[model samples]
Target: MIELAVIALRGVQYALISLTFGLPAFVLLNRPHLDERALQGLRAQVGWATGAMVVVVPIAILAQTALMAGSWSGALDPQALLVVVTGMGLGVALALRWVAALAEGLLFAFRLKGRGFWFPAVLLGLVSVVTLAWTGHGAATECVGKFIHQGSTAVHAAAAAFWIGALAAFLWLAFRPIEPGSEEEARAAAMLTGFAGSGTVAVAILVATGLVNTAFLVGPSRVLQLPQSLYGGLLILKLGLFVLMLALAALHRFQLAPQMAARSAHALTHLRRSLLVEFVCGGLILALVALLGTLSPPMAM
Candidate 1:
């Protein structure tokens, strides 16, 4: 039961952190091409996501404390909190995440604009995701191996944030009441189309990094034991969900997107449904990831 709570908290933390960075970066990248109303919508999403992170991050930290100490009561212990905030790797990472979350709150509160504000805000968000590497397996290694693993994991996390977080953003756009054949609909379609190229690239990176991380966590010898182990089973489930997400993404790129671009009737409705399914799938993947983080891989044993 405690483990389940940890997994749930971790999943929410990952999702919210991903969105905190992903939404702002998406808006920054596409703001020029988006209509005024669309840009405003994106900004609103960013604010909401950032605000959410403010509340989620501290709770996640406390959950992590409990998980590490093996009891809920440990979460309130000053020494445990001090260790989490000051210890190497994960401890430092958690402290950094807290600082980043606070920074985001300040940005959201003031409605800071211009390059100065946005540039720093986006950087902080990216840092928050990258620092997550320290909380996982990457931090267990030493010297050069640690550096290589942490670097790859950071890239993997960033790419994932870009892909999955943008899906959430796109899902928001799909719900807007843009009439078929209208300028707003056309702009929305173009945005989705543009995302296809970047999304594909992100997926490719995710796949490659996934393979690398798998090699580190579950070597070739453990592959045969996958079905026999809980960690391996969950890993397989995650991969299956990832493949499903890929299929849905392909449909979006080749089928629904094209129809929407052509202003076909019912295209928007179909696309919206597909986006919602994809978002749900993404959430499942994150949940699996949270669970996996708590279990020992077959190879590690």
Candidate 2:
């Protein structure tokens, strides 16, 4: 039960982390050009949503650290407190910047052509990369070869962001309402397809790097045995959810999306439901991630 709970928590943590990074990218990519009202509407929605995340994510971090660190006596352990506070501060700031970059990307994408789009897009991209790199760099526990470790870790983090972000973006755009004879719908559909195609390379990087990192942390023998262990079991559960998400993505990308693009309402409805299911499952997977981060892996124990 403890193992299960830990796994659940880790899943949530990772999922939230993924969401924190990915939501902005998703928002930015889907921003509508040629429509000022739609762009403004998206900006407003993102602003409120990002603001809420900023507030909640830190609280969640504190709650999580307190839980992980267990009881504190009269005087808090300064190092523990510092670590927790700094980590949370860094993460929250990065997350906020990520959202900002996304919003900026949308603004640039819609309003500016050529160089204007390139500048904001480049700025946002660099910020996202740096923030993610920092998050990844923080994962290494040892000081030996810290730079090398951090660099590898950054690659891993970026890969996960790309995969998770692509999946999230695909889910978001594919499910939204599509009206027949509406240019908005057609453009959205085109964007969905284009984005999905672009995301495929990111997905590949995510999977490959993830495997490498997992291999480094857990040897092949233990990796095979992970499902029997507490942390392993939870990891497996998250993997299952990921697979389900992928399946839904495939359905939408290959089957439903094209059908909807062809003006099939029935296909569009199915795509929406499928994407919603994937999103729910993604949430569950994230909860498990939160738990996983708190648990001791078999090797560590």
Candidate 3:
């Protein structure tokens, strides 16, 4: 049970790292502050996220092994090690892609000011996809089967990023307070709304593609029987979290967002409160994801 929890925590824990790293990245990208101080701050933010990924994954693997065994020695085989490394590597790549996207968005925002821009976001996105494919190929298949599985996993991963990743960003912005009655506040809100719309579209794609990938990864019969197994229980937990995220998203989109757009102080307050709640739930959901990753599949049981 402890091992399961640890496994589940791994992904969720690291997911937070990306969010922590990304929120500021978004801010830096969307509204470029040319000041040396701002640049230094952004660099530090990126560094912290990168540092965490470098330091934490190995510890997580060791901790997981130790949880399963009395000691970490000989607890994991080469294949398991490969899987862990690949998973973490993919995560790092994905995080970079998100950062890059934020950069690209910033570039577009810059274009409004007559600056010629390059495709940093598009380039980083492609890199992210490539890394994901490289990591997934090991699990999906070794040859042509590798490409098929890689493509499927990439689709699934992108969906996950759209929904889960974006949720993390929204939560961050929500929890952090914006100054009252300021021009920067309005600009911030506009920037946030643009991304919010992007997130919405991403979520839609994620859901549609996630369903397809789920079908391929786990047969319908196994999926149906998932509730009976440990994996199933964790997956159910993840699903519940996902549903909660959806509900919160709706509130943000239909309810609070309009109020905020109108600059209604009351609506802004409500949006902040709701965002805080969603952040907490998102954190919990991430922990469950980490546990789910560690469990054996329902079919395996």
**Model 1's lDDT to the true fold?**
0.82
Best by lDDT: 1
> What's the true lDDT of residue 216 in model 3?
48
Give the per-residue lDDT digits (tens) of candidate 3, residues 82-144.
544455654454445445445544544554221232124324434444444443323534566
Off by over 4 Å in 1: 114-117
Off by over 4 Å in 2: 1-20, 27-34, 57-140, 143-149, 162-177
Query: How close is every model to the real structure, measured as TM-score?
Result: 0.94, 0.70, 0.66
Candidate 1 TM-score to native: 0.94
Ten residues in sequence with the least summed lDDT for candidate 2: 1-10
lDDT per residue as tens, model 2, 20-96: 45545555555553255554443444344434444454444444455547643311556655566556644454455
Sort by TM-score, top down from the best: 1, 2, 3
Q: What value does the lDDT take at residue 190 in candidate 1?
A: 79
The alpha-carbon RMSD values of the candidates against the true structure, listed in the order shown, are 1.7, 5.6, 6.8
Q: Where does the lowest 10-residue lDDT sum fall in candidate 3?
A: 112-121
For candidate 1, lDDT tens digit of each residue in 1-301? 6677767877887898788788777777667557667766777776777777777767777877888889999899989988887875677886788789788778767777755555776788898999879888888757887888888888999998888878887898888888887777777777877888788889999998998888788888778889898988899999998899999998888888778889898889898999999899999988888888888876568
